[model samples]
Target: MRAALALLLLVAAGTAGAQMYKWKDAKGLTHYSDTPPPASARQAEVKNFNSAPGADLPALLAEVARSHPVVLYTAADCAACAEGRALLQARGIPYSEKTVSTADDHAVLKKAGSPGQLPLLLVGQNKQIGFETATWDGLLSSAGYPASSALPPGYRHPPVGSAAPRRPSAAERERQAQEAARAAAEEAARGKRPPPPANAPPDFQF
Candidate 1:
């Protein structure tokens, strides 16, 4: 029940449009607490909502294109459509927007193999529809976006060198993690610092 409640709280914090709360426990483990966390623990867990979910992709790509070239196809007045534009602007991305407000616009989108999902982003040789966060992030990342938030700010992104691509192979990541862990453990043992938490029990640290 506690875990379920925590999950729901996390979801509501994002979906019901509430602020996010964060905290770090005694063992350097982070947690999201609805209430304020300790002040001196490096960082307390309390922050406002980043933004609404499901952004308009075309607009987002355009904003990213401020640093690159981006193309978009969109119609007017769709809620998702609005989000698409807002996202691009928020990220400071500049793009070429082709409004499909007329039959010719509709024909252009169809001829270009784009769906009628309003914000259709074309980054390089790729085309994506809807507000797929991972896909947008990947496309923008590939097209040289300078580390903008694809989603609202609270949504996490991967580290600089490590990208969380859409449908990344889990096994490959696991194997790499294992290899890194083994290397770290070996280094620690050679330096007489125990095993360096290689086989530390889950949830045992925090």
Candidate 2:
């Protein structure tokens, strides 16, 4: 038992030292490999297996996630969306959720080629329009996720966010307002003529 335990420790140490590279190609598809990314790769990142919290994820699961990241598009008060989310949770699939509850979110959904469908699932470049258990399972399987839960204990999916770009923060809004005010002040200082009065005749000049 002592010998076996030591051997396991040695293996774990070796695995922890392994390096992984993650990057996006020109087409914006993400890739992961043990080798350095090619010259064309963008947003390249290097990770040591055990360098950070939750970085000790199982080898196969980590590789699969990097190669085929999963995204779920959902809307509030939708039964199908709830079911879909439940399925992913039950399977312990790490994924990002995008809530589609606004016009901007709907536009993003349309851009993704959905005809306003709820509970859209995207596994890498492939997409599924609705929540069908078998279909979703099949897509996940094809993307290399395990048949059963393999998630590490205490692992949690990222917090859900809007499908559209997030609204500017208060500070950002303030900065923008100040810039606009400054521009207006500069224009006024330049004596730029104001528009003619709305009540004036069409032939009236400023």
Candidate 3:
């Protein structure tokens, strides 16, 4: 009976979605079964990863994305940023990146809740300042991302950073537009608009 039970457990371990318990008998023989071990035996749980709910994966990932959107703030020529980017790509995590290359970029990074740290990671409101692989992995796993990558082939992330996109609010947009128009009008009134150079397009207004 012991030999038969051990063989059965081995078979069960190969199958998807199989739940089994492992323990050693009084004789020190290892055994596994779908039922609980006897009180005298030591118990351990064995999980099968292959049978994890495939149908629910999409919904699970979507919920995580909604509740914890991943954002990475990086900069060019930074070794840490490069490593962090590679880690995210390897994990097939979908994330948005903000590159801090200019004054405007620095302002945007600050507004995103960092103390001007490069390679900062933001999961929803949770801030991780600096690139640490183990910490990043732990947080992402806790947030319910799959252990293996789920990205499809040929997936390309969009380009990073727009010169000061987050810094300009609607009011700022209107204010800047008004200022530009005022400057243009004043120049026109003073007839100070410089004449286009030779071969310049007629539509050119300086």
TM-score top scorer: 2
Model 1 lDDT tens row, 63-82: 44322344566666767657
User: What's model 3's overall lDDT?
Assistant: 0.65
Best-matching candidate per lDDT: 2
Question: What is candidate 2's lDDT per residue for 1-206, written digit by digit as tens?
Answer: 33345444544554354444679999999986543455578877655453346635588987777666677889999999999999999998877778898899999888765789889998766789989999999999999999899988756565576777466799976875676666657666657677789899998876
Global lDDT scores for all candidate models:
0.52, 0.75, 0.65
lDDT of 3 by residue, 1-206 (tens): 33345445546644334224566888888986433345577434332222333422255665575456567888889999999989988997766666787887787678777768788887655778888999999888887777778754544453464425444579976875676666656656667556788898878766
Q: What C-alpha lDDT does candidate 2 achieve relative to the native structure? A: 0.75
Error of 3 at 114 (Å): 1.6
**Which residue pairs clash within candidate 1?**
22-45, 56-83, 56-84, 62-93, 62-94, 63-93, 63-94, 64-93, 66-94
- After superposition, which runs of candidate 1 have C-alpha atoms over 4 Å from their true positions? 1-68, 149-206
Clashing residue pairs in candidate 2 are none
RMSD of 3: 26.9
TM-score of predicted model 3? 0.51
Error of 3 at 78 (Å): 0.5
Question: Each prediction's TM-score against the native?
Answer: 0.38, 0.60, 0.51
